[model samples]
Target: MMGALGQSFINGITIGSSYALVAVGFTLIFGVLRVVYLSHAAVLAACAYIGYGVIEVTNSAVAAIVVATLAGAVLGVVIERIAIRPVRGQNHLIPMVTSISVAIIIEETLRLTVLSGQPISYPDTFASTVIRLHVGGAEPYFTVGQVLIFALTLALVLTLRVVVQRTWVGRAMRAVADSEDVSSLLGVRVNVTSARTMALASMLAGAAGVLLALSIGAIDAHFAEPLQFKALAIVLFAGLGSIPGAVVGGYLLGFVEAFAAGYLDTSYRDLFAYVLMIAILMMRPQGLFGRRLTQRV
Candidate 1:
């Protein structure tokens, strides 16, 4: 039983790390822009397809990931400049509605383009099974990829902390998050900062897309929907604008879903995500790391 639990814990971390990456991206965008960016998932899925094409041509996973990241970054820049910029300073709902429309368009384009009712597979390089750490004295070993996922997650968390706390760009981003008006007054180039934030968020999404495609070994348009909701849940639960919160929230949600599948009904795994979201909202509306809202009467 102890061994079983250990293995399960490892599995949870592996899945949770991916969740954390997605959540981080969501939170980054929210921090600087205050936009929900519902289309981020479409960007992820579209990049994965682009990665798939790269793999097909070069027969290399690394090459494919590079191409995908560049494609995703460019897409993010275009979307922010074209689709999102027009609605800037309008009611928040206007941008959100625009994002939803863009998401639909992206999905439809994906369905009609590279992902026409078929699953795209990456090269065999991603198919090799790596050995994960041993647990339970002798049984049920996890794979290397799972271990990599957890390690990569830790690395990402550390990188984010260092970036935010140490870099000039990080300070500008924080300044914007704290108060865009003040940031602009300080000559921080608010527009540039916002654009960079969007690009950075999309880059993270691109990396997550690569890992996700590798883990699943397949890519399709429909697969993006669940990840989209999952990422949103993580960001919401982690508290808007809090990077560490996003990490913690992602891991928590991932573990809950995994354990639910193990102990409760397998079908209840996803249902539990929403249940937890609702419970958190009812009990603590601000979320785990979210700040309390203040309003003037």
Candidate 2:
């Protein structure tokens, strides 16, 4: 009983940490762009596939992660220039539509070009280690994969925090987030900063995707679709433009899904997330960490 509960909580945190990493990128883009990039999930999926393919060819996860990050960074810049830049000053709705269209195009192209006939598996380098634990009177153990996930997640989060809060680019990003016009007037190069922000966000997403592939041991285009809603729900629940908020929201959502699956049924795992999101939205539209806006007449 107590052991099972403790194990469930640990499982929840592990799943939530991955979600937190992915959600941070989503929240960052929204904070800087002020427009929802629906293609984020698609980009993440593509990066994962690219990483898996590279690993298959070179048999090196490190090499694969590097290549995937570069690819995602370049693709993020391209998407910003072509699909997002032109509609920058315009209403967010236009950019939102454009992003969705780009998502569909990317999805179909991946399906046609990559999965022509066969599917691919993301071979794991640490799949053999087994670690078990006994707590109280119930059964719930941990594995090396779960341990690796936690370590990778912690490293990524710490790296992001340091980069965003300690580095020069981080200062520029904060300035832009504070006020784009002022940042531009002060020689911040708002356009470049915004593009760089998108690139960084994409790289973060790529890292999360690679971690996800490592955990699941398979790569497929459709694999990222489900993540889209879950990631978005976390970001929205935490607050659309708050990075830390997204982290908290993601963990909460992850735990909810894990507990629901463990106690109820696996089929309703996603249902729990959506239901929780809807309930939160209905009760507090501003989200858990979002600031309440004041309108000026």
Candidate 3:
């Protein structure tokens, strides 16, 4: 029982780390633009396919990841320029509706053309090897892919923290998030900041999509939908714009999923996630780290 528990814990952490990556992207766009980017999942799926193509040509996972990241970043900028920018400052629902339309177009395009509405096997990489670790009386085993996911997630989160808190672009992003008009008055390039925010968010989503596909060994156009929803829940759980909260909420949700699947049924894993989200909202509507809202009469 202990062994099984330990294994589930490890698996949960791995899965949750991926969730964190996606959630962070969601948080970034929301913080900067205040628009719910419904197209992010489509972006993730599109990038995964792009990664697959890169692997087919170069046969290098590293190359695939690099190309996919760049593609996602470019796509992010394009989406912002074409779809989002036009709707900016409109009713909040306008951008959201636009994003949904864009997501549908992208998904259908992939399904009809490249993906053909079928799942594609990810290129085999570190997934082929399993590393066993012995600690005291507990021997837990993990795949190279899982280890890579965890390590990369840690590094990415740390780097994101530094970028958001210390860098000039990060400062610009925060300023824009606070007040776009004020930031522009203060000489911050609002357009450039928005573009960079989208790029960074999309890159993170792209990396998560590729790594997650590699971990699972297969991906389809629909694969990112559930992940997108989970990312939303995680972002809310972590606090809307709090990067660290996103990370922690991601791992917490992961553990919930892993333990639930391990001890119960896999079908209930998503249910558990929703239930947890509801419970958290009921207990703390502002999220674990979010600030309470105030309005002047």
| The candidate that achieves the highest lDDT relative to the unseen native structure | 3
Q: Please, what are the lDDT tens digits per residue for candidate 3 over residues 81-139?
A: 88788888888999999988988999999998974788899877655477887766878
- Clashing pairs counted in every model: 1, 0, 0
Assess candidate 3 and give its TM-score to the true structure: 0.95
Q: Assess each prediction's global lDDT (C-alpha) against the native.
A: 0.78, 0.80, 0.88
lDDT of 1 by residue, 1-297 (tens): 665566567667767888898888889888878887887888888888887777778877667667777787787887788767788767889888887788788878888876475777766664347555455464656654465557766776788778878999999999988887888899998878777787777877776777678776778776777887888887887788889998998888888887777666779988987899889877878888999999999
If ranked by lDDT, best first, what sequence of candidates would result?
3, 2, 1
Over 4 Å off in model 3, which ranges? 133-140
RMSD (CA, angstroms), candidate 3: 1.7
Q: Is candidate 1 or candidate 2 better by lDDT?
A: 2
How big is the positional error of residue 75 in model 2, measured in Å on the Cα after superposition? 1.8
- True-structure Cα RMSD, model 1: 2.2
Off by over 4 Å in 1: 130-134
Candidate 3 lDDT trough over 10 residues, lowest sum: 122-131
Candidate with top TM-score is 3
Candidate 2 residue lDDT tens string, 128-196 = 255667766666776665676677677777787788889988889889888888888899987888789
Q: Residue pairs in steric clash, candidate 3?
A: none
